[model samples]
Target: MSRRLKNNMLTTIAYVVVLLWLFPMLYMFLSSFKFESQVAVPSLTFTPTLENYRAVVTPEFFKHLNNSVLVTAGTVAVSAILGVLGAYALVYSSLKKANNIYFWFITTIFLPAVAVITPVYIVLAKLHLLDTKLALILLNTGAGIPLMIWMCTTYFKEIPGEIVEAAKIDGCSKAGTFFKIMLPLIKNGIISSALLVFIVTWNEFFFAVTATATQSATLPVYMSKFMTQQGYFWGKMSAAGTMVVIIPILIGFFTYKSLVRGLTAGSVKG
Candidate 1:
């Protein structure tokens, strides 16, 4: 085939694959609007209504939403604070050349969270943090901190050393320089990392499902209730699932432009 034709063929293949990957999301979205009785009759002929959305607006739904929001907000706040502090320390401290410390920090990224759940559960149980938002907040922040630090450190390390020197020369304290200069400079990175942390916390199932009971259950755990002892409640499940899926996605969308720039900020010099 000619090069132009080959390029067109590749483009076509890419579009096909993209559509294939999106098919399930599209199906779930459509099925979510469907009533339980209409689920079996899979046709697009029925008019889409706010019935499912209405179902999602109940007190129970709001309770789960509130829990999710609380956990996600707490996780993002804690993670961002710790990430910024940790990243700044690692970059500016005497241990900058300590490869062992850096290596351990980087290695934490590879540790499967499931491996640590037992210890976390024991600790939480002992502290009476089980079935509490505080437990999820602390756990999610700790779980996400490794990656948050990694991203923040990479971005912070790329910052010009002259800026720090300039800040110090201006009689700025270390903490002042960090808060005034570095924080503003790396705001994008902070937002990006916070968004990612929020996404992970919002969709957190294993920890939320296992650690929390109904009182503190997040959206993911609450939605799981749709799968009853007898069988699945497809309508309610779809409604809950759709709601659960949209919040973080909407959060990402709002910050997406900044996040893209932040993720790539250090990758290019000019």
Candidate 2:
């Protein structure tokens, strides 16, 4: 094919791919404001309403929102803090023995969460933490750490050892090297990881479903059960889903520009 034709073809394909991926989300958005009869009508001629969104903003709705915020914040905070420190240790420490001994920490990611849930549940139950905010936070943190470490490590590794050496020559202690010299250097990684981890924990369903009771139910679990209780109340369910979806997307939009810049924050700084 000619270059012009190929370019046109690629553009068309890109449009199709984007539309294909976005089709469901589009439907979900549209359905959020639809009445039950209009929800699956397969036509766009009908008028939309705000009833669903109004219902989604109720006290019950805020309950789920609060649950989501708690879990997401807890997960992101724990993961970012631990991930930063762990990556710092990996980047700076000379304890080869420690490396081998804790290589298993990274391997925890490969294990399916389902594989560990039974024991985790037993332990949490024994501790009376089942269905509590703490259980979700700790579990989400555990799942988030490996990926957080991997992302943070890449950014930390790119930092120059000379900077760390200079800090030492300046009579800086280990604490200073990390908090003063290194942490700022990897702030982008922290931002990237924090945003990404918050998104993940916000959407996480597995443990949120299994471990949390109604008292701590997240948006996903709330939406999942909302449909059943609604008895084919498609509009309300879709509205709830849209609420859950839109908040994170807005969060991303507000932060992603900063996140991209942050990811490369200190690469060339003196």
Candidate 3:
């Protein structure tokens, strides 16, 4: 095939992939405006209404939304701070076994939540932290920290060590070098990591279901409530799901450039 034809083919393939990815989300968004009967049928020709959204957004839903927002925000903040510091230390600290430490962080990422749920439940029970937003925040922060370190380390590594040396020679204290110089340079990476952490924590189902009764249940748990013994409330579920999805979508949309830059930072040198 000619190069022009190949380029057109590739572009078409990309569009097809994007359409495939977006179709489900589009369907779900549309379904949220549908009535319960209409949702079961799944026909395009129907009058859209806000009834499902109205039913979905009760006081309980707001409570769950508050819980989700708090947990996501807290997890992102805590993880970012700890992860950035840890990544910086791993890259620049003069430790003999830095590789071992990094390996430990990476290993924790592979550790399944199910495996540790029992011990986690017991610990939380003992501390009387069950059914609390703080518990979810703490759990999510721990889960996020490993991922943050893994990602931020790449951004930190991309920075030249000579920059640090120069900062030091210019009488910049270690703390000043880290906060004033290094942090700004890797701000995009930090934003990317925080956004990822936000999405994960927001959509976290298992822990939210297990740890929270009602007081601290997040949106995922709230969305799960639509599955009743009578039947699935598809309309309300879709509405709740749309709400759960849209926040992250808006956040990602706003940070698209930063996210792309951060993700591709270490891909090329010079």
User: What's the lDDT for residue 202 in model 1?
Assistant: 86
Runs of candidate 1 with Cα error greater than 4 angstroms are 1-14, 37-42, 47-51, 266-270
* Each candidate: RMSD: 2.8, 3.4, 1.6
lDDT of 1 by residue, 61-91 (tens): 7898899899888888888888778877787
What does candidate 2's lDDT look like per residue over 1-270, in tens digits? Answer: 899999999999999999999999999888888888888798877798999888777897798899999888888888988888887777678868656634676788788889999999999999999889899999999978876876776777777889988998999999978888778877766887788788878889999999988888889888876557437778888888888888789888888876886666534432
Please report, in order, the local distance difference test score of every candidate based on alpha carbons.
0.82, 0.83, 0.90
Number of backbone collisions per candidate, in order?
0, 0, 0
Q: Which stretches of candidate 2 lie over 4 Å from their true place?
A: 1-12, 97-103, 229-232, 261-270
Q: What is the C-alpha local distance difference test score of candidate 2?
A: 0.83
Give the 10-residue window scoring lowest on summed lDDT in candidate 2. Answer: 261-270
Which window of 10 residues has the lowest lDDT sum in candidate 1?
A: 96-105
The residue-level lDDT of candidate 1 at 127 comes to: 98
* Higher-scoring candidate on TM-score, 1 or 3: 3
Error of 2 at 165 (Å): 2.5
